[model samples]
Target: MLMTGGEGRMARIHCKITPLSVYLVVLAMYSTLMMLACLENEELNRVAREQKQKTAAPLQDDMAIVRDRRSQHGKWLRTVDDFFKRMGTLETTCSKMVSLGGTYCRRALDNNKVVCLDEDVTLKSTNCTVYSFGIGADTTFDDQMSHYGCDVFMFDPTVNQETIVSTNLKNERFHLLGLDIFRYNRTHMNEYPDGKKENVTGEFDTYDNIRRRLGHESRHVHYLKMDIENTEWRVLPNLVEGGRLEGVRQLAIEIHTMDIITAPAHQVLPLLRQYWQVLERLTRLGFLRAWYRPNLVLETLYYVPGENRTIATCFEVLYLRRGPVY
Candidate 1:
């Protein structure tokens, strides 16, 4: 049974993986494990930071008063506002305002002390929707809404990143889009008698197009601000009639109302009637307030036979869709 040296070696031999190969496997596992750990930690930190900032915003504003123009007056008015504001309650007094005429706005406060509004000092917080259309015109509404926790989608087609970015609004909640909503048309025109004749540069888009570009999957639009001039008469009805009305909470439109004297004799009354019908319809739907604000003095510009260009005044209409968050 004694074996040769080759046979004895074959029976007793053992094999092991090389140390370098083992080291390589361990190194790959360690690298992968470290990467996954780092990724999870990074995600956790990001979420934590977002939550902290969002929660901290209110605490900061509460400590210090924002040094705004009417702050002192607002403070004084707030004292008076609190007493009477609670007394009347919007639900009860809003009906009175409709019939009380110019004096009713004053009725909200003292017996006779109506709010003297130079720049629309309505003093009350709007729970309804506003569709603001003009750009250069100061949007006190946007400022007021942002001060509160309500989401505001401000559209400034002027297209400046700085103005939109450096907003006091929270980056996540506030969305600003630079798009012009228009009726289906090849050419668009703006006519302002008091303001400059500026041509809009961006490609016109539809309402659906705008919602997609913004990438906000929000089903109901709380405040739809439209500064889109004459095109509103054409585009707005579609939104109201096409089940899109349910999405809008408030719509403030700087409506371009051409002067009856300036418009063609046949078209003036009909145009007025068209707007009246729209307002009546909205009111019938519980949008009880149709406010006219002369925010700007605009000139009209049109092609008038031989003149080649015509101009008229652009006015503002704040269409308040009543009821809280529909």
Candidate 2:
């Protein structure tokens, strides 16, 4: 009987010890997990700090430069960067613009000789120059532009398969010509996708020829609008290279396809990076104080070896050149 009681005591002590061992194991595991969690949090914080520093270093550097010396106010730099960054968000804002929105700011051209969308008709007197492949009679350019006290020059090398000259028109001040801004007359037009039956004469010319033929000895252009399909990538470089591009005061243009058209000259963009680059170049030449892209055209050009396929696609931008508020 004593031996049996001794066995009971041993079993009781083992049960107590077993529970204590389990408690120790659980505590050790919990401590290990807490340590791992702290390590992960530290790594995450490190990565976030690196990213923040990378992102903010430039701004801080600009601040340092401003502190070093300055001509403009401190607020000006921030405002300019913020404005452009916000403007960069407008990549495709005009890709689907249907009409003048009720909240649209077309009045940006107010208090000037040139007026944009829904322009006021009171002070109608100025010369208008439109650069396009061609302007059909259906465009508001002829009647309205002439009536607005402006002599209109429609510049193009009308290349249609048929009766492009039928679209050709002229008046006392409204003239149509087959011409373009080119380099030493090294200009030529591509064949139309439709057919040769309606093809017109040479639709391409150099900037030198365009100004010499149309400038009437004056190098100034009151207004300019270019819609030469996707040729802007190639043509814009030449325009900017010459001192002649500064002749314009008001500008509007249709920049055509980029998605299906890989402009070897302008690089391939699914959006408007290159177009904006060209505009920025012009703006630096004292062209526009500000500009806006308010419309988009649905058209694209597709090239498939011998089987050439072109589609209708383009984007439009209107710019107001620098001038007095009056």
Candidate 3:
């Protein structure tokens, strides 16, 4: 009985020892896996930090470049504003003159034949030189100025031969020419056949070329009128660059496509660019806006389609050379 009791005790001890050893082995394996996992996590974090550091320099550089470009553009706009501050101030002019044939044919020509003032009435008698571009079938403006003893040169490409033939019946002081003002000579008209060309001769000439051709190199233009459709944009710039405005006393220009008035000046668009360029050139030439009349005849180019609110598509501006208001 004693030996059997001893054997039972040994069996119980063996059973308890086997389970405890298995539990210890499982616990040590779990601990090893946890340590490996912790090491791998730390290594991954280190690699991520290294990658971010590698890309940080270039990212900062790109940010800096963007900032620099913005700064440069801002500076450019500031310079333009500074230059515009030096332009001529507004000056008022007197009564509306008579329109020849069209309702939009009138502008103040000033009092004197040489230097004009805002309050001065049109000269009643003077041998001043008046250059009128874009004469569309009506010579009333020229005739009136001619009656004032002014030598008016009227140019238009569409004037009929019969009209030129009847010039004697028209203003005797007016010289009508079948020419159109262009940035270049119309020699290219020869490329097309006579009947195919839109212009009678397709022989458009610049203002400077006309002055040289017409023997007015030294003579000053007392009054200059331009209503050449949308060609005024190109023609006016050419005249400015050629120093033609130096001798022009009073200028009446029909600036087209002014409906972009709603646009902000800093917008990177073509209209604002042209607008600034025109203003700068005119200001540099000592030209001041004396009067402005909105043109209701033309359609707005920039506004919404068919929205008839009168957006100033085409307008007449009378400019007087900046001087005393005699």
Candidate 4:
């Protein structure tokens, strides 16, 4: 059982080599497992990036569609704004502009109704005639015209009075008729002050028919004032077509754009186009705009598209005939 010294030394060397060989095998196995883990992580990262690209493609397409629609809408709004500017521009100047009805009756500091008249041509005779429409309780303009020896005929369908009432001014020259100026000769149902809707029989007529009835067909209207709500857009074309405005020297009208301002976004352009056409017709009939004032007392504001500010929906515009048409 006893070993020699050389054999004992060889056995001790074998034991030391066996432990070092086991340590090297364990280290190699750990390195292989780490390499497999790194390959699995790289595959997962690639899948996530591909999934993100797939998700973002549809969203980018949707954003492009929205931007294109916005650009088209902006272009439509700009066209409407240009038409509005043309309607408001003044074509001529009034040298002797006088604001009739000096007292403000409608919550305004100044009167929006103005008359342009030259001393030599307008209101110079006792036979001068004035027709005032839409007289709502305020007769300052009618009364002042009567004082100038002008035959003042005021018309209002909403007034609480008989068919025709004569006022005590300048030898009873002011005649207030409960009639309406319409586009046709027909009965119009108007709401009175008592909130009753009555068919105003034989009370509405076209400007030409009314002129014939009043025996003013051959005479000149020195001053014609109209504030007939939104009816001007309807009645004015008939007047121009029938040559009713030939004898009118001065016209003071209040234009209303409430229908356009209150319409839907899609309908605003069509309504404004109709309004512009009416203005163009007036211009062709030799009626030039002398002055224009936005009625601030109404406080009806319209937000013009593609603009940062608002504009008044109502305007008091005065038009004068260029020369003697008759």
Candidate 5:
């Protein structure tokens, strides 16, 4: 048969191509494409992992990164919310309770302690007892509470022996203890000694030891008031942990802000923790904030120049135990 050069070339190609050969060519191409795709996917995954490691948090010891993320001011604001939620909810608890003394002795409520009475409580005012943690020579509340028939036990290391001997003049019902209530048992030197000595040795007492020493092991406290100048933070948590607050019906505490009282940029980690510990323990112990009064006076200012707009960094909060008092 006569054929052109193009026809002859086509006939040769057709002769060389068999079905098995065509299938082998297709299989080779597919295998090559799969190998390329696998390599590309592996490279992409390695790049992704490297980027993730680079963006991760710094690698360091757990102790170095331990910190409190909550702000002191934010926690203080939350106390206001807690107060409203707990106030006037307990029928047995006094609703007419008030701050007896001046601004310093303010609590959540402001009714006179002497005249104020709640008949629904298990312990009556006549038979109840009050434990006052700190008294800076102020006996207004103590005097009122005494007159109303409650025995008041006051403890303050700062009070001198002369003042202690003059108990009859202050209030016969008020029993002043020389020991101070602190989270730990430590000795503190008195700033002003009777004979002009700068450092007189005084001991700080713990809650458990105080109970044992005073023979109040099984007693129930009708009221408890604290103004211990930042000591409340640690002391409250200790009380909560030791189950020492099981019998306390009412608690009036003064919370001081570390921002104003603490030294500038000093060992502030411990001070900041006090706030969190107290807040958490209060929630766990079934205690509710019944009242909160902020003291805006005596704001910290510069020695020479300052602004009066700044408010004080202390607040008086009253908490009521919700559960049964045993």
Candidate 6:
């Protein structure tokens, strides 16, 4: 089976060319497969983008409806994600701050009320008038103010009494009235100690009516303090709307954010917007936030859905009316 030199050279060439031809054919198949894969990926990406756009259209429409409703109400609404942060922030600056009452200043539990006394002469005068609301069982603040010769009028509906009681302080400058400040004039039902039924009835009146009744319609209230649990959210709006706060020089109030914090995720935005509107209205009324402290006793931390960290549910804020002494 021995072949000639020319024949052997031809056979060797055939063997090499066979493998090279097979390699070229396999290379072509691989290139085509890769091209098909690239095209398939591009198609998938295009379809995904289209699907996303279709989904976003409905969301945009819903937002438009929200915008329309906001416009109808004539309110500039804020998103819920940043509501707590904005609320916790101090909006104004106070040069001089004085803490009165309680055991200590800035204590977590039963902290002293912070007041701005920058160039303020009303609170130090003997003719100063103070209206203190929500006087549960503590009158330390009223007592201290009375020590300054300021007339302190205290109001509360849950004092286990049905009628208004007037008490004279040691300095004869304090008056206690069992009444509640509310948006409207109504009868507040006082519950029994056993929480069985509300058998006692107390009067709740608006700030305007109360001031008129006390003949303080034209008199300036040098200092006003309120700690009406969660009713402040309602009472404050009424006072601002009725222009009853125009004669007040300083306000120390506790604001509760529990409503927004405890609401369902879907309803959080509306509640936060309402809360923001209240603060915004106060700001518009020239109420500058001088100082704020968290109520550490009822400090509950909740992880809001859109917020990264937990937020405090309650805070005591001091707002000083900026402008004239009145």
- lDDT for each of the candidates? 0.44, 0.45, 0.55, 0.65, 0.55, 0.64
Among residues 3 or more apart in sequence or in different chains, the pairs in candidate 6 whose N, CA or C atoms overlap within 3 Å are none
* Model 3 per-residue lDDT tens digits across residues 197-283: 434433466776777878889988878988777777666767777566766767877767553545564542455345546654664
Candidate 5 regions with alpha-carbon error over 4 angstroms: 1-94, 103-123, 165-200, 260-274, 299-311, 323-326
Count the clashes in each prediction.
Answer: 34, 25, 0, 0, 5, 0
Q: List the residue pairs that clash in candidate 5.
A: 98-109, 98-110, 98-111, 99-110, 108-291
Worst 10 residues of 2 by lDDT: 92-101
**Which candidate achieves the best lDDT against the true structure?**
4
lDDT string for model 1 (184-205, tens) is 3233344555785555444456
| TM-score of each model, in listed order | 0.44, 0.46, 0.54, 0.63, 0.55, 0.63
Sort by TM-score, top down from the best: 4, 6, 5, 3, 2, 1
Ranking 2 against 3 by lDDT, winner = 3
lDDT of 5 at 277: 56
RMSD in order of candidates: 23.3, 19.0, 27.1, 26.0, 20.2, 19.8
Query: Tens digit of lDDT per residue, candidate 4, span 155-189?
Result: 76555454335444443333333324443244556
| lDDT score of residue 162 within candidate 3 | 53
lDDT of 5 at 116: 26
User: How would you order the candidates by lDDT, starting with the best?
Assistant: 4, 6, 3, 5, 2, 1
State the lDDT of candidate 2 residue by residue for 1-326, as single tens digits.
12345546523233345888999999999999999999999999999877654332223443344334223322332321232332323211111112221222254421111234322111225444434334532334543455555556655444332333443345323333543454322334445447633434454666567567665546466566666656776776777775665656455566554554555533333233444455456544544322344232223433433554433344455544432111
